[model samples]
Target: MKLYEYEAKEIASRYGIPVPRGKLARTPDEAYIVASELGSTVIKAQVLVGGRGLAGGVKIAQTPWEAREAAFKLLESSIRGVKVNIVLVEEKICVSRELYLSLTIDRAMRKPVFLVSEMGGVEIEDLARKYPGKVHRIHVDPEVGYSDYMSRIALSALNLPWSSLSELSSIMKSMYRIMVEYDAELVEFNPLAYSCEGKLIALDAKIIIDDNSLPRHPDLQELYGRELTSYEKKARELGFSYVELDGDIGVISNGAGLTMATMDSILFYGGKPANFLDIGGGASRERVREAVKLMLNHPRTRVLLVNIFGGITRCDEVALGIIEALKEVSQVKPIVVRMLGTNEEEGRRILLEQGISVFVEMDDAVKTAVNLTLK
Candidate 1:
């Protein structure tokens, strides 16, 4: 789940990170009161998305009245299709430099990677593309964890003084710890800057925790449910893309193109797909398991068809998820898997051992699943 900027900053402050004084306001009056206290505040729409500045979701207010006006204009607005019901009123910081720092899941390496850059803020994407060499990254092993020396080495590339390096390194350590502790897929401090007071402060922050790990951290739940159908909502909760259909066969794949093709093939083979689900790239066993369970327990689904051509995803992990769902779910349905890509042989072996057939051809799998649904 993606935490709003203010929510992410709240977590960061608890870890001893410096952030501008801010208050979350639900109304223009609340924003006015906050701005009166802070003086010269920045009003930002609290939406779970990026490019807020470009979308006019952000405004700099020189006075409390301006803050109120900005809040009144932004509240009840929409950014990238998401409604903004809250705003963050914060004291603007005067900084000498803009920098970027983050730790995120490295699926291919199966570890967390730290990214730091001199060019930061909203334009960081363009900067990185234009000058790729400025942005530096290091893959951190989960077992070894983060090391002070490693951070310092990476920091030196930016040509920083020893004092600055020590401070930034400490902050990086905290970020790394937060990512692991919170089961976060991404923890970021974009435009991590140095104020006039010589203190490094976070101007913006983002955190995305794994939805599958949500049960363990009930305290972090804040986002409300979307107005979607039962299966669509369930798919969102499971961190996958899904669309309900009036059919008897459930389709699962890793990408949109592949999923569309799977559904088309199902139709071609005379099978009506009950739903379209994409488990996403580099899906873990738990994620796959959740997807499988969703399909099997679905009332409209009579058969489950899984077609995975893994690139970042490991077929063994996919097989493990399928097996876990079959073992745990009470209702059993006809499941046919067409597995390929990394660890294919091992995945087939695992599925075969569980008395489940794994198909190598998509046509065969689709035909079999469609035929099974007729029974």
Candidate 2:
């Protein structure tokens, strides 16, 4: 789950990381009130996705009236097709220097990586590509978290003045500690600023908590009150949740590894995965229907792929779910299923009786799905 900048700043503030004072506003009038209270504020559109500034969703206003005007223009606008609903009015900070810092998991290395850069106001990816040398990354032990040596290394990489090094290092340590305690997958601070007086401040924050680890942090759940889609709400109610991705093929798999592999397989065969849908073990017909319906709602989805290597989940049960889902939706795209495990023969027989296409071989199923996607 991702926390908006306001929420992330709240969490970071509790740990002594200096962040700007801000308030969330749902209306232009509310934004005016907030700006009046804060004074010389920056009105930022609140959205889960990134690239808000480049999309003109961020505006600096000298007065409450200007802030209200900017909020009115931004509130109903779409940044890359996603509607903006909330705006954050924050006190604009004066900066003598800017830096980018983050603590995130490196799945490939199975460790947490600390990223530091001198160019902070812009997107990190752009800086990485244009000036790779300006960006410095270090992997740390997930169990131990960031140490003093790591903090010093990150601070040095920022190339800040020697006088401000201590404050910068302290802020980096605080960011790392928050990542460990909150079970955060990403804790990013952009334009970590150095004021004229040598004080450090966090200009913007982006945090993504580990959904799988939410059980341990009830406090986090309350802070992350971002709106959920109806389909996602239903899935969460049923003890599972999904987020739609941009691709042509929708996937349903038993586990995360298998789900990712299925997506990769689709890509390997010249097709992109529309979403990552993990039915998990012991999935029933109802769960299957929900997953399928969610996929069908995706505008980019052109094909469905059900790749199940049943361990505890029987192949016949998964097949029945697929059939039931087909009946529930008014219209659905082509489906290519690959079932191999317990009751594989029975599952294939049932699907064949319905005249549905089923592929026992993974290679053939992926190829067929790719072809269908192209069409």
Candidate 3:
């Protein structure tokens, strides 16, 4: 689960990290009010996705009028297909230098890694590729946890002034604590700026909590619930996983691994997936109906692709669900289905009877779905 920038900064502030004063506004008038209070502010669209600046979602407003104008333009637009419903009006900072710092779970090493870079405000991946020597990484031992020594090792690599080391180390330790306490998968402070006043402050914040840890933290779960899209909320209620994408093809699969593979195949064949919907194990006919209905409801979905590699989930049962769904839903969007394993022949027969084409090959099914979108 990802928290909005304002939400992440709020969490960071609670952990003794310095952040520019900010308030979230839902309307141009509210943005004006917040901007007036701050005098000079940065109007930022509050979206979960990145590259907001490049998307024209982030702007500088020197006055209330400018703030209102920025808010109007942002709130009326979409970033990466996500509607900007709220904007963060924050006090603009005077920066002397920008730095990057973050803590993230390293799956391969099975430990949390702390990353720092002298350069900031750019994509870390690009930074590492262009100036590999500037980016530093340290793997924190879970058993011993983050220590002042480890903090020194990470910060020293940045070659920051000795005078800034103490405070920067404190901030790094605080961020580590927040990551651990909140069960976060990532806590990033991009462009952690050194202000003209010689103070290090977090200029941008991002926090992603582990989805599996939500049950243990009701407060974080509530925060996440508020940010979920309608389809995502419904998917959770129906015991499935869904992620919206910018594309015309809606993909439904029985397992996460297969679902991802199907999406990749679609892209490889010059297609884009509209969403990722995993029906998971033991999906009932009702669940399948719900899934299909959900996919058809997406305005961007030009076609639907169902790929099932049944093991515990019987292929015939999946076929029945799809048939029932088509009978109930009003949309006439094309659907391509691929079913293999466990009563595959029976499933194919059932689908054939309903005038639905079923494919035994995954690539063929993906290709058909992609072709339908072109029509």
Best by TM-score: 3
Worst 10 residues of 3 by lDDT: 151-160
Clashing pairs in 1: none
True lDDT of residue 297, candidate 3: 78
Clash-forming residue pairs, model 3: none
Error of 1 at 171 (Å): 0.7
Residue 180, candidate 3: alpha-carbon lDDT: 85
lDDT (CA) per prediction: 0.87, 0.83, 0.88
Quickly count the clashes in candidate 3.
0
Query: What is the clash tally of candidate 2?
Result: 0
Q: Per-residue lDDT of 1-375 in model 1, one digit per residue for the tens? A: 888898899989998888999999999999999999999999999887778889989999999999999999999689877778999999989988777888888788888988778777845578678889988888888888989886786667545667787777788888988998899999988878876766789999999888778788887754534435667988888788888888999999989999989999999988899888998888889999999999999998889999998887788999999999999999978789998888999999999998889999999999999999887
What is the clash count for each candidate, in the order shown? Answer: 0, 0, 0
Instruction: Identify the candidate with maximal lDDT.
Output: 3
TM-score of every prediction relative to native: 0.66, 0.83, 0.87
Residue-level error in angstroms, candidate 2, position 315:
3.1
lDDT for each residue of candidate 2 in 292-360, tens digit (9 for 90 to 100): 776766667788888887777777887788888888887658888898878888888888888777787
Better of 1 and 3 by lDDT: 3
Candidates, ranked, TM-score? 3, 2, 1
